[model samples]
Target: MVFVFGVNFPEQRLASLERFYGVGPQLSERLMARFHIHPTAKIGALGGRQITDLNAELTKLTIENDLRRKIQDNIKRLRDMGSYRGRRHAMGLPVRGQKTRTQITTARRLNRVDRKG
Candidate 1:
């Protein structure tokens, strides 16, 4: 299963049925009315070709230029916070939390076997 625009698209064979989860029964029927596959068609046996075509169509319908701008702005905001402290501030995490007695087991060690030798 794959999600696009919060709607789940099951694998190709089940693509039409998957629309039922995201769309109302009437809409689902209207959308897939053209496809006259047998109701007994096994979900796994449904052809993936239709699923791929639907995915392409959904991509074309949902993506917009304003969405592109919003994504670009978010990327710029992240990039502007250059340092770890700046990033922590942007993410609302503690910048100066007490580390006393905290586990250092996972801390990266600068000194390795070669350096020790």
Candidate 2:
């Protein structure tokens, strides 16, 4: 196993870095390129120095809980300001003008004043 940013990632392909919150395909590819790790490289195949470098790089990013908290803060700010989007989020409705006539379950589940990470 390899520990990256306080999370344990078992010996898996480098592409699995996308499993980290806020690290999408593009971000993961960039991270791999920076480390010179092959796309198919497994966690166990990484050298000691490479692992340390990865840990340092990940620490500089606002991923996982940090990113979630940042988003929640932004929503809270809007709510405090009484913005229209904040009202929608507070009411558990679509915030981006999506039709609420059908398929609004996603909005109700996600757009909330106190959203869970």
lDDT of 1 by residue, 22-96 (tens): 345554454445454454454455456644554564454423444445554554455476755445444434434
What's the lDDT for all of these models? 0.45, 0.87
lDDT of 2: 0.87
Note the residue pairs that clash in candidate 2: none
- TM-score result, candidate 1: 0.30
Top lDDT model: 2
Worst 10 residues of 1 by lDDT: 108-117
Model 1: pairs clashing at backbone N, Cα or C within 3 Å: 13-46
Q: Which stretches of model 2 miss by more than 4 angstroms?
A: 12-15
Provide the RMSD of all predictions against the true structure, rounded to 1 decimal. 12.7, 1.3
Error of 2 at 110 (Å): 0.4
